[model samples]
Target: MFQTDSENDSAEPHYLRLRNQIANEIEAGILSSGARLPSERKYHELIGSARGTVREALSQLEAEGLIYRKDRSGWYVSPKPVTYDPTRWSGFMTYVAEQGRLPATETLQVKTEKQPPAILDIFGKGVRNPLYRVERRRSIDERPVLVEDITINPALAPGLARHNLNGSLSGVLRDVYGLVVTRNHVEMRACALVRHTAECLGVKSGTPGLLVIRTSYDARGRVIEYDQEYWCANAIRIEVDLTVA
Candidate 1:
């Protein structure tokens, strides 16, 4: 059931009343996580408000991290954020599972291509050197949350093209290629999701998103892998533990 702005809610913005009502329901578990909300028209009709007012209220909730919009799909109550620690050398499956969530990965593309100019500069490789590139979409609890494009130095992981990439690449590198990510350099920023990446992650293009670029090094300090990951802005909670020397 929805409520209209009564005497108690008279002083506040109409949308805020709706936003608060929805948020209260979510916090009280009336609207469970991953639950789809009513369509804009339905919501507005229920509340006896304009569609624009309903939309504004939903936008406020989204900005508060209580809900999210899926491209071509209706809004949903955001699931618990997956905590990510960039300093840890861990696999996607590992962290997701640790949080009691199901993790799935879909391989989007695999190819051997001439080293990209940026990759070449990082790897210090010849222009002719071919790198193995893999693009993947990863999901938690059936919601696509990340799209990652990764380039691997073929010289470091021979026969990598033959492995099943739908699983953890970190696992494959460790078990098959005998390579370990001893150290890594990670950079993160807020960005507008590109069309292709947004589509892959099931979000609207130009949505504010999180970008993480990581370069992994082997024990010998060789650049083993470079990857860029695009994430749904509300789908993850980045947490890092630090100790001062």
Candidate 2:
């Protein structure tokens, strides 16, 4: 029943402007899961547009899985994207909690190690960093969300498990290792889940997931963690939120 159009960007066409306005509300978490969207008549009033224009916007949203319309009951908001908040300092647990979902971790392996060459390139340095291999699966409300293989330089966080592998690595590094993360570089691409990865993540080998390659550095600009996260493809739509100074 609320207005959708804004005077901020008046140059755009009325229907397109309305569509974007409604879409942003869905993305921002203000309009929550299962909340029925206003009727066409209501949206027409809200956007100061024609009924046909409002219907076009609604149709687009429905096609994109952002909302759905019942035969007679009208439109309702889609579920929130599987929450993967970039603003958070913590990992899956903190993010899940913020979204009101319970989180659990499956720790498959944690072992001291030397640097791996492929990972060395990711860190952009020599492979002599003295590292450990940490493999785990993170789940949201008992549903698998991510499978992570982290190569952490022991020099950064001595006896990393002494802090906690089940929760925030960023916090542990800062609290125990006295290191602050100043940089993070992420690269995402699509790949088929391998048998090993899929088995750990409860998906099939052919299942598509996002392979996220990441390098994290301390405030001193030292590479600390070189990791790959296999996120369930259906779990989230990662977006960059940026602002100009």
Candidate 3:
């Protein structure tokens, strides 16, 4: 289905032609989500195009969010990204579950570390003592979607590490520590996945992704948690709602 003829007299650029052909296939449902694409060499051979042309075509598709690449594996059609509303007070698991998707968390590492300058800057006296650092990989319906690095003030929840860390941190804070999160200051940006993040998310380094930095505050206006979350660009769609008085 991907084969192209060299003698075809199309005026379009080679890469554009290839990209459009692949896009048409995806649109027609000939290539479904999660379907692995042909290897670069195979695609080049099938289309009789230059290797660079095939690579460029695939890269374009990836940028358009139609395809994704794994580290050692080739490209695959991407599933529809999940919709997320940062303004909502709901936690990740709750929101994902509401969307009819199963959400799971795997605790990768947990330790106490000296508060970084950035964290200290955000929390100041609130984070004066050593911070409890937790790295977790979050998945939806068995597909890894994001990784989060969370820092907490140990003083607020002593012996927190002894409890199950795979569950909701927000739930733990509210139920166990009696710290109800009342507000979140969030900052979002588009970024490429770094090596470690990419490895954790099963994507190639430099893959396009979203970065969210969140500072959670308790009812008393004390910073309770600082969270850095990296999400696959193809796996999330962010939405915001505003009302004016």
Candidate 4:
């Protein structure tokens, strides 16, 4: 059984004391990343607190990005976040490998979709274009990180649907269609994961996450692709380097 410091016993809530203890152990590397934690029942027994108190402490740790709960699997220490540079054109696989982490992608669904009104606005009003919709989930070190829904202008890359999408679509565009991304417009916002995406990432629905919307354009300024990505909040860190004029 664990005991709180006598000085803290009177000053802090039981759950806060538990949270601080675990957080300190994690920061001190006593609890290594990816290590599964003791069950709530076990923790409460060890700490001499209610199971609900232990659960609340775990929830706090998760919100602070120090831990995660894998459905059916118990809590685990969160891995160090992957740094992502929104300004860089380097693809996901390349960057992830550069950081000495394994990157993986799974193509979930691929279909030819009629231009929805929002899509038509981007492709051009009243343009009857065939858009390819692709759904994918990406992981690092076998832990699911993000899910993306992509819209591709098949007219820009003929036979795009025929190609395997389990890899980088940017590579497919460059190698197969001879098109390279020259410009991108990116927007980010905090969101709650919807049901489908939440399931894909192995998180509960309505879990807090980050949404990244990207529209890629070629040198001639045509919108080739638009994708929306829902990222596990603790799994990634955004970094951008800029040059001063």
Candidate 5:
């Protein structure tokens, strides 16, 4: 591992030193997601600091969702940070392309996995029952921007493979399936990027990332699509448009 500044030997709290060093590594992309940090003792020796100091720093980082401890394992870097916009009703590809970057999808994994238990519990269905899933790394101006895992009603849009994914799913839903999207119900929260997300987005595990839960509705107010997008912090920003009545 490429080590940076070690903790100062002064009586300053040891955890602060650890926090500063780890934070620096994350911002620099040196200690990316899934990057395992040295053990507490290792950190102590590496920084010529006390074990308690290293422990304190690790604790704070974990609490902030910057690092996590594994069973029989150690701490690791989180994935890319995520940014979300609660104001925009447009879909992911549409919102991103409007920013002037061409949209693309690599289709890393698209088969189907059991819907997360919480999701299944809420929807009360097979959960994974025939969801049209498409996972991709979203980018802007050729710079990595976000990773999107979108799931839609396969019954609504049966022939997903025939659609041109380079553009927006909403467009396809409108033009091909004739299911016009008019609105969406959305929510936002803070979370840490786990192993998979961290590896793909090039951040660390337990790193702070945005969590978006949205249900897109069509002209008939029917929930046709649901999506989760893990966006890098600096990749994009959302601004609300206002009008004076």
Candidate 6:
């Protein structure tokens, strides 16, 4: 049902024309989210273009976040990314729920490790404390989107490893330890997906993504947790509210 004969008259490159045709179909609702795209060979036949041309067009679409590829699987239209507000104090489940999407976390690993230099710098020198390292994969609407590595101060919340780590850590800190997170110091930057992260998110290494480092403090200004979260760039949209005095 999709044709590009009329586009041949244009001056655009063959791949560009093919890319625009597919993009138009996606925008016009002819292709739905999660819909599998035609195979590269099939597309070449349909558009009367070279196979390499079809591949280039698909690669372009993937780079633009209009589509994504699964390992050993072909490309599919990307779903709309989730909107996130970093200023909000609520946890992942809360914000995702507000957007009418299901949220889930899979705890990958939890163990004790010596405090890293960066964390020790924040907590101050002369402190010898063993920290709990937690690794988790987070999903929204059943789609894997984020991977997190959290370091917890055991002195602040002893026996934290005994509880379920798949749920909200903030909730556990508040309800069990009475350590409420009052403020957070956060830094954000663009990063490429590492091997471990790519395997977890089912994406290729070197894919562009967002990296967030957050240090949460309790009411008394005590550092409670240090977290590093890697998010698929196409799976989230970051928003912040700003005010000028």
The candidate that achieves the highest TM-score relative to the unseen native structure: 6
What shift in Å separates residue 79 of candidate 4 from its native position after superposition? 3.1
> What does the lDDT read for residue 66 in candidate 5?
73
lDDT of 5 by residue, 120-209 (tens): 453445435646677777665554556778876667788776666756767777788888767777776666678888788776666667
Ten-residue stretch with the least lDDT total in model 1: 2-11
lDDT of 4 at 67: 91
RMSD from true fold, candidate 2: 7.9
- Residue 54, candidate 5: C-alpha displacement in angstroms: 19
Please provide, for model 4 over 161-185, each residue's C-alpha lDDT reduced to its tens digit, 9 standing for 90 to 100: 7888899989998899888888999
Ranking by TM-score: 6, 4, 1, 3, 2, 5
lDDT of 3 at 165: 81
- Model 1 lDDT tens row, 29-144: 99999899889988887888888899999999988778987776999999977999987767789989999999999998888888657678887644347788899999999989
**Model 4 regions more than 4 Å off:** 1-3, 9-14, 39-53, 70-74, 125-127, 241-245
Query: Number of clashing pairs, model 1?
Result: 0
Off by over 4 Å in 5: 1-85, 90-104, 112-128, 241-245
- The TM-score obtained by model 1 is 0.81
lDDT tens per residue, model 3, 30-57: 8897899888998888889999999999
Look at candidate 2 and give me any clashing residue pairs.
none
- List residue ranges in candidate 3 displaced over 4 A: 1-30, 37-55, 69-74, 242-245
What is candidate 2's lDDT per residue for 1-245, written digit by digit as tens? 34555544467667676777788887776777779887788778766778988888887776566776656998988555565545545566676687787778777788887665776676665446557888888887676778999888776666886556777666667778787777777778887788888998776576667888788887767887777899867666776577898
| Per-residue alpha-carbon lDDT of candidate 6 for residues 1-245, written as tens digits (9 for 90 to 100) | 54555556767798988898899988887888789988888897787877888999999999888898876689899887878888887788888888888999999998889876877888665556678889999999898999999988788888998888788988888899999888899899989997999999988889889998899988777888889999998888889879997
Cα displacement (angstroms), candidate 5, residue 194, comes to: 1.7
Instruction: Work out the TM-score per prediction.
Output: 0.81, 0.62, 0.81, 0.83, 0.57, 0.84
Model 3 compared with the native: what TM-score?
Answer: 0.81
In model 3, the clashing pairs are none
